[model samples]
Target: MQPSRPLDVVYDPLYTTSTSHNKYEGHKRRVVPNKRPISIKNNSGLVSGPERHKYFCRPVLPHLQAETPEVLYASAHDAANIMSISEDLSASTRSIGMQTMYRDSHAQTDPFSPEYVLPEGAVAPEIESLTNLRYRKGLPVTQAEIRMIEHNRKKKALKKVLPPMSDEASLNLRKRMMEAQEIMDLKFRENEIDEAHARRIEALQESLAEREKQSQAINSERMRRLEKTLMLEKEDANRRNQHDRIKELRKLANKRQRIQTILNQGSKKRDLIEEYADYASPVYAPQMRNGNLVRKSPVPEVQFKDHQLMTLDSIRELEKNLPPQIRTSPKNQFLKRAPLMKKSRDQMTMETHLLNVESAINKQHVQGEEKLPSSPYKGQYRAILQRPSTPNYAPQIAEAGSEVNALRLLQRLIRGRAVQNMMYEGKDRRAELIAELRESEEARRFLSSSFQVPAEETEITKSAFSHVEGEVVSELLDVLQKELIRNKEIAKVYDFAQKAAEDRHQREIEEGARRQLEDLARDRHDQIYCFVTDIHRSTANDYIDSIFEDAVEDLTYRDSVVQSIIMTKVIDPILNILEEENSEDTIVKDLVSSFLFPWVQKHHTQDQALLEKRKYTSAIQALLAKVSQSMRI
Candidate 1:
């Protein structure tokens, strides 16, 4: 008989040994049955003293009983049949049968056989032979049964199994695998090259499109510049023409003045002499002598006809006689007595006065006394020529006529001189007046001509160009400013977005690390029930609280910074719009309010906290305040 191998056992007790021993001792002890005695004699094979006492003391069996041999045989056969049926059932189920079959097949092959060995002295043949034997045995099995057997065999074979290939063969196989991998890598590199070429082509097309747009913009700008230059040239030409016309008119005026001066100098002296001569000459001559009187006449007495003389005398006498009565009257006195009486009285008086004066005065007074004596004789001679008393009227009439003629001539000369002087003065004055009139007329003509190009039309044209240029300048300024602001905002937004993305990435990393720590803690708790208690009690709660607080503070700070940025970027622009509105800057205000505000609102949604902040509303309120203040200004 073979001795059985010793069994190995290990036991663990949680509590201390003393505590276990104390508990065991306190329990009531249970009694076990004593062993039954067996009788054997040492050499004769008889019962011994201790064995005889045990056998005699034991009861003996009574008389014989008959047994059925056939019954026993039948029982044995039935037991054998039952065992066979069980075997058949296990085989039909397939998994148990396949496992047994694979074991039997592998048992037939020697593990150390040459067929199971490899050339390099490694043991691939053993694994191969075992796998082959298992495969053959399992071929008739169902798919499920074969899978179960294969799984069991792989699990068993994995333990203490030799390497599948010899060392040299494995190196060659690895090299082939590496070559295949290199081929796949080369194919992938070719695909990447094609993709890069496509990208380059697309970039070039985009650049070409941009260049075309730039060329069009340059052309438009050049055309505008050319138009402006042409307009300036035209204006200069018109001004030059106006100046030339004015110069021509001045030259004509100088020529007219020179002609007028020549006419004045030639006419002056001749006119003065003619006026003096006309005054000096008389219409008739008067006769005059120097100082002496001479008598030149003989009296040829023309005798009147006798009848006429007598009749004259008679008539005188008759008239005297008839008018003696009437003579005394005022009307008839002169006709009646004048002739005869005057002659007689004159004769008497002459004789008496002559004698008396001659006597009274002596000769010197009458020195020519001799002449008095000759007076009688002189009667026969020519009666003392008594000069007929010439009347003084001729002198008076002559003086009056000369005075009148002189006055008339003087008046004529004065009038002529006045007329000539007036003509000379008027000629110069008229020239000037005409020149003034011509200038005024020309100015009027120019003004009238200018009206053909109405001021409103010219002004409208000018204003249209000015408005277009101003709009261009304003638009350019606006676009440039907007672009600058947009660029600045984009930079800020990019920075903010980058910061946010960074923060998110950092948070994800922290969360992943925290989860890993939590998993480690949980694993430690599962493995050793109390391992995590110190960490849980002392560090975890405080760390979580600090992290939450810090996160909130950082978010609040970021929000504040974003709000300030928005105020600088967006609020100020809005305030400008509002200010413009208050000043009645309609064009500017309309552009900003209508075009810019909506643009800003759309831009704010990207920031997490900024989106939640009521920044737009606050900015609008601030702008309104600014507008109100500006109105007061």
Candidate 2:
């Protein structure tokens, strides 16, 4: 019979509050040293746990309270039991709601790390708590089984029995049979062999006669035999004769060259002596043709003239006499070759330039006395002499006797004068100004900035039209100019539209690239995670098989070798799935506590499918859904 649980270990409500209505605070003293910060000051704690208030300060958690009735203040054994039960509850709740595996997957690891291979039994490592494994290879062997094993192995190798005349023994028997048959043939006599040979000879003769008859029944012409040997003999004899003749000619030519070289050497020595001695020979004298003799000089000068030559005398003369401007070394090599551009092209040479300067100086002296009227310019007042000296009392200059008409006076005195002075004055008044300027040539050449062509003399110069040389070229050039102008106008109007479209397209491309990068990162993470997950799924069966047969095996809850196997195998996978794709926010902690925790409580603890591992997969899927909801991924 199985033993029952001890009464001492069995737990019940340690105490029920004597007065359930009111609460008490100060669950413990706050003078304990701890690694974490404490809320103690001046030997006084905040009255409760880390979080406390006057009205709310009490035992922080109901489980934290060790309150017991005096009657129930029993022995240390009961206290030990209480502590153990409390520890178990705390451990179960302490799981981060996750474990070490979940923390590792989310950590910032080294970038250069090679992919890690997961240990066996990462997923539902064991199916049922009581299950074990057995393998057929590990069965026991016995001493009497040895011969039987060999016999069976041989039988399996062949798969059947051998027939009589089939193996190597059969081959040997065939070889012997062949030898016996060959020996039996030797019983025939030599005379029989000779008779057979004679018969073969007769057959050969008959075949030969038939072949001869066949050869005779053909059309034929006599062919001459080529004597290759005689042709080779004749070629050798001709070659020998030619070689002898060539040798004789070579010897004669060598003797003639030696004799000529000796004679030429003697003549060359005599010629050298004559050339060096410079004797008065007839060859030195020039021959006259008819009565004419060679000219004494090669060239006759047209006239005696002085000219510069590149010589030491010319260089010395330049050094002593030339001005610095003309004798200077080369410089300004990069300067463009352009004609000198004077401001006034009329003074193209030095004489004209000097004339222009002299005249400008005279004009400046003449106009130097010009001055302003006053600092405060008066718009109305002016010298009476320059004011046209209007008639003082309607002088009879208009000849009042002629007509006293108002319209005629307006036309003559106002309109007529204004038209004559302002409209057509260029024809008369311009000529008068030019005559006056000519009289005062000094003023005409004035350097005053205010001097300008009179308005009366102002004429729009007409452009001279020289007919363009190439009509086709001119037309094409005009078309090109018009095309360029038209294109510029089009671009000015529509360029902004094209630029805006290009900018929009570029932004779209960048946004798409950003999304692609995000997708690639997500896929990379999935690939790494899938590597681990594949191992986990594969080890699921291996874990089941390892229970008894394997040296090391993942324990189920019933046969736990480490901390609860459910934490590593079942709970960890769910947590990993939740952690891998989640941002892990606390905003949705209520969802996990209210929805997921309750679901696991209702399903995992009650469903029979946990034995079949369906509960774990379902639980993980549900957890993943909650995680996704929290992350909003």
Candidate 3:
């Protein structure tokens, strides 16, 4: 069996190595790989190890694993190259591919060369069944076929061991499926019911809202009608009052003219009668009976004075007999007397009473504690007569002239010294003038000082004025300086007091205006809150947008809008968040006070809008609390 040339290592399943033991042969072969060197000279050979197997076969594993129809031709080609069994195979081999294969008995080349030496104790590796026959024959072998076979075996094994489902199990599964279907149906019905209920509620809300709008419209109409009626009535009353006032004025004017004419007529008639009596005859004098003037009474016992004795009949008789001038005289016109209408009579009586009462009061006031009749006048009188008088604490305002006079005095002194120098320009009168001014200054200082003078006549006056005008200058300067100092002190005090009073007045005015604005804002807040929040959930932004353009000039409206914004934008959102998070009344309030209060304080601080919103803090907080409580309920 030994060959002279190195031969291909043809695979043989029955071949044994020197280290292998064969029970059938009843011999234990000795491991002599190092000595024998398992080459072509030796018949026994070692089997290929995993390294050799992988190097030769796994390189073509992908090609071998192909199961496509094209792989059939390749396999035939490989088969023909190895076997050379048929012409068709040979033709297929040459045409489809150029690959070659070897049979078990065929010799190609020895993987181990003749000179190769095996290592000591080397043994042939056991054959892997994965590459058994196909590898030995140099045919294609792959894991894909082995895996398919393994999968089929596992499937059959599982099928043989697994048990079938029982009737009870099938029934239980069917029951679960039916229950699931019933649950789905029940959920669908509940959703439908909920949707229908929501629709009904929405419809009811719409109807109620419509009714409310109608009622509001009717009420507004009634209110407008009532207002219009009241306005007409007021106008009518005012017009009637104006008419009555005009009539009363006309009557007064006519009464005044009649009184004036009567007064002039009486005066003229008296003057004419006096002139006639003095120049004409003694008969012109008022004729009198035994104890009466001019006319006797119808009753013999009745006696009257000259004017009272004259009757209407006598005046008419005189009018007819007199000349035209005397006939038409105003005295004879009885209609031109004092006003005889009741209203005019009443007015005259009132005036006469007022004058009489005033005169009596003056007489009583002037008489000094003398007892007199009580005054009939019940109206208020100024017991302490009001007149313009100086205040007790009169401020002494500094006169402008005082400071100017002091400055002028200094100027005058300086001018005098300069003039003195000019008069003695090149002479030595400077020392004399200095001595004279010094003497005058010393005398003035001594007099102005708080030193007591002697009771006896002092000779101070003799040394007072060293020069002609020095005495006047020193005295006037002292007075002016004192006046200037006093004026400054007065001015300072007056300015401080005036500033204090002005500040106080300003504060009072500010406080009053603030109070009025707060009152207005509060009223506006109520109106806006009622209008904005009266309906269901809605924001103030929509309402604000509707009115913002039209009501730009209305500050109250703007303030109300700002307040509503604060409620909706700031207050409502925070309240809703707090409500959703925690519904407890106490917890909600605490959260509002802790979180919302500070937030509102920080954000609601634009000056004009701030005043509008800050005032409603308490109201808004209460509203928040109320809303939270409602949500909880």
Candidate 4:
């Protein structure tokens, strides 16, 4: 049987067809439901609609019928009459509730109706199983019982592990354990040594194979080189044999040429002049191998002028007065002033020198300082460089755009022909502007045909009070149109000027550089000339002569002019050195002094300290220990 539902629904017997009023007694459906239509899902017969009641329980359950109706009626009647109290009420008030909600519910319902019966209390089951009953345990476990059990089982096991044996037995057991451990260690070490031996053998085999491979490669390379050498030797022998054969053929050709010449000559022998003429044929121009022109020396006497060919007396005097380096050193005599034509000189010396060494050194930072500043505004000048500069197209674009805009404005004014109308106001003026702009084919044809529009002239007398506004209007329009055309033409001219400036910028820069170079060269030439003149004048003066003889004795010369030239050339270098500015000289000199002084002083102090330590060395250790204390105090 299915489990009982929690909610029990009681059907009303009045809805069931009552047989009591008829001949039969039970209340049940009298009509049989039509054979149910088949369900497509389950293929089972179904009873649907109001006829489904015919399949409902028709059992004569008189037991439920007696109390079920009455209980249901009571519950529903109580629910109808009942009103819930609000949460605001006290619990005590609710517990001591008012009169029964169903006080008159029993009277409202048919208490004595034949179809209804009184409700009874729910019945209890008559039998129940007793095996699942729970009861208290017999006794509780104590600590003494737990201890007794552990002593019997756990204590015996622990005592067996940590045995209560004699010392000799324990020692015997340890000896056995040591023997087993030693045997195991020996086996493990043997395994490790075997592994190492196998690894070493494998490594040696690999190395041996690698060495064999290298040796084979070396042998192959040696054989290749030997074969290459043999090949080269064979090629060399072939070249030598070919050269010898060619040389012999050339000699035979010379013999044939001489015979031919003898036959051409009419039994005449050549003269000595003719024989030497071939040898004397003018050589190719005596010039630089690279085709540059060869320069000749300006000075007539080379060694004597340079002080290389000095007399014994001059040498002795020079040695006594001159510093070692200034007394014609080996470098001065062996200078490569003019090296062989085939070779470059160690030092290049021009025959006509424009810049002296002094000027060159002075112009290291600024080559043309006298003519040009170190830097200039680059935009104003043309750029002169090996590589081209990127162009700045912004100005070109702007100028072209402005010119186009001006031209467009001028064209619009000319084409629209609304000048007079625009000058005035009102709709009529605007209409006149439109009419003037509109071209008439008839007027164009008449003008092209050179025909005139015949009209009667109505002359009027001129008055002083006449309006002059219209008179100047045409003139003003003509002037305005001319000005617009002039502006566009001006813009075109300005654009041309800007382009010309950019295009010729490079040439202008080159010109400026050339001018600057010329100026510097002129200045240097004048400076050298003036310096030589001054030295010559000074040599003639008694005071200058006495001063040179006494203070500057090393540079004495036999020729006054040579001495003047040398002095001028030499003094300029000293002057350039004196003119130079060096802010770091003092700083670097002080730094060197600071470092040298401390280092030298430190060594001196160290030597002195050594002597002091020797003197104190023989003193007692106690005294030496107290020395630091004494110095500190």
Please give the distance, in angstroms, between residue 550's alpha carbon in candidate 3 and its true position after superposition.
Answer: 93
Off by over 4 Å in 2: 1-501, 504-514, 517-521, 524-538, 541-633
**Clash totals in order:** 5, 0, 2, 1
Better model by lDDT, 3 or 4?
3
Could you give candidate 4's per-residue lDDT for residues 533-616 as a string of tens digits? 998887679687797786655454446768788778998777567557545686578779999999999999999999899877
Query: Of the candidates numbered 1 and 3, which has the greater TM-score value?
Result: 3
> For model 3, how does the per-residue alpha-carbon lDDT over 1-633 read when each residue is reduced to its tens digit?
786542222233355555665443422233223374555485357456655554443123434532322222222235555465466565744554332444365744323211122233553222222222444453354564454445545544544554444788866765676576567557756866676656765675577679989999999999999999999999899779856865775575566556444434433223433544353432233334423254322222435577842799877776687788755646544555664896786677668656755765574465435433243232223133222232232233245568778899999999999998787874564778788889999979988772566634344544543554687788999999999999999999999999998678656655765688699999999999887776533556667766886677688788999999899999999989977888698786896799988877777665658677777997899999999999999
| Superposed model 1: Cα runs more than 4 Å off | 1-174, 246-633
Over 4 Å off in model 3, which ranges? 1-166, 268-633
The Cα local distance difference test for each model comes to: 0.60, 0.53, 0.60, 0.55
Instruction: Report the lDDT tens digits of candidate 2 across residue range 1-633.
Output: 753643322232253345754232222222344455666445464366644433541243334322322112222345687798689787846543322322445753212211122223343211221121112221234432343355435544442333346789877866676565455445333544666556765565566568767665432211112345556777788668756755665565566456444434433223433532343422233246433344343223345555675588987977888788887876766967577665334235445545655665564464345442343233233222211222233367457655667668777889778877776777675888878878688654663422475544333211112234366679989999999999999998799889997678656655765678699999999999999999998898678776665534433534674557778888899988887867657536856788788888779766665666886788899999999999995
lDDT at position 67, candidate 2: 31
**Model 2: how far is 463 from its true place, Å?**
16
What tens digits encode model 1's per-residue C-alpha lDDT throughout 74-97? 222356877987887778464432
